[model samples]
Target: MAVTDPVDIRLLAALADLGKTAVHELAAKVGMDPREVAYRLVALSGSGLPLLVGVESDPQGLRAAIAGAPPSWANRPPQQQFPAPQQFAPPSHPVPQQPAPPMPPGPGPQGVPSGPYNVQGAPSGPYTVQGAPSGPYTVQGTPSGRYPGPPPRPQFAPPPVPIDPAVSTWGLPQTASWARGDEPARPAATGKRGKLGEVMETQGLEGEQLSVQLLEVQDPADYLFGAAGYRLEAGERAVVVHTEITNRGSIPFASLPDNYLELLAADGTAIGKAPVSLTSRPPHKIGVKPGETLGGHTVYVLPDATRVVSVRWSPRPEPDERTLTWSIED
Candidate 1:
């Protein structure tokens, strides 16, 4: 019951990072099978981990599963467990017989037709039957005495069941560990604000320490944007923020370092980062190794009238105390 398995620990750590993801997606994150993920979650929940394991089923699929019937999506005929009963019928007409040929004058063998005799209306010979069908005689239906071989065995192929776009194959958990009060409260954000070119250390999702610094801020970067073969809408201007991230802990920082970097507007609205990248200004790569440093450029397009206040960075989707902000000077 105690969570001591290394695999279970890894699964829990991934679940903590992912929050509420599908079982298969969580499995992909941990390099395990979806069924295994589901089983482990169930076991962990049973062990008082406060984990929630839930399933979603198609209405028709539930009925089929309960009734022991093939799902409608399969589009197959009902299986015939045994071959159809064989039917038999007597021949429609009797086969005609011919009279024996006349024998020689000498006394013939007693009770035997001594001379050549036509058998079954054919020229006389030993063990010959005239007009007999080549194979077993037809037993039923048609008057013709020909046997049709057993009905061709029904051809069956695995059914192509349609997957529901809304549901994952391994189903989804209704609630995550955090929602079930299993995870500790998120760390409070430090009240400190750094100016541009100042470094601030923060903890990553996996407890890895990282040093983040806002290196440069470019306002009205339209010329650079245009040079990148991109066009902006009228009244829109681009801003590019360059930052450096260094992993200071032994653990590697595996996520995009600037994923949640954004600009705070003068009116307190948060402007999100754009996906556009500049070729000359290389964008942030995926990860930073331990003791390694990486620089990244984040681009944002906003209305020219909007006054940018500060640059904010957070490791999570939502800004928290761990988030760092750098005031922008006009």
Candidate 2:
């Protein structure tokens, strides 16, 4: 198909996946002009398809236009139902779309960072989180006895820039109740703490807590990292993992797992069992209650300081796990 086809598909997919989206992000993700995304969004919205497009700013003042919620396009054109592509039409009248239930101000389940929720927008202090990053990066194929069709993969699924929810300050969850304090917690490892999954058909629990920190959209490159190292000697050469965990959520979150560190190759390949790196801390489970945080670190000892590649914190429960990643040159 032509390039335009993908844009149409993405517009439909965005609604299907995110529930709602803005025109700029829709355009950016689908490689289309903002006007086009807006145009399609208007059409879809009028046809009873839900979508939201708006402007938001980060802590540093960078602005971003966002959109979410895609409409399904199962039917072909001509015979398919099409709505006017101008104004945003709330789902056809009469059928009456139900209003969202009001959320209470209390400690809720942990989830992810997604919303336009806001508070005073003023930051209180340096907000800290609880655990390490989610599912650590897996090294691409290491040649076994025989090789497969392709090469080893070092895919990078970088987490979204951590966004601190502002709701907590006002005693409400505007963006999410994610245990990670900032990022939404994935159930895969959180072990049933705070999560945001579709429980019911039309209604359920969601991580709708938005902290003022969400206003701070960090530059991916400017992000400071935290790493945990193991089995070290004296001054071999790994950046010390001095970490601090603070609870910025509305509810209490679990602690960093005992096995929260690993020695991976430049491509995130694991070297061995990530030894327990709870240096100078209790040997028990580590945790942070709402409005609290914890900190820990490890001294990295390089076998050959010259052969040193890099280091990082492994995956743990807390959703927005901050980590340290770096490389040493010969």
Q: Which prediction has the highest TM-score against the true structure?
A: 1
Candidate 1 clashing pairs, residues 3+ apart or interchain: 189-321, 189-322
lDDT, model 1, position 278: 97
- lDDT of candidate 2 at residue 288, scale 0 to 100: 45
lDDT for each residue of candidate 1 in 259-282, tens digit (9 for 90 to 100): 778899989898877878899889
After TM-score superposition, the amount by which residue 140's alpha carbon in candidate 2 deviates from its true location, in angstroms, is 54
Off by over 4 Å in 2: 1-239, 271-285, 299-302, 305-330
Residue-level error in angstroms, candidate 1, position 288: 0.5
Q: Which one is best on lDDT?
A: 1
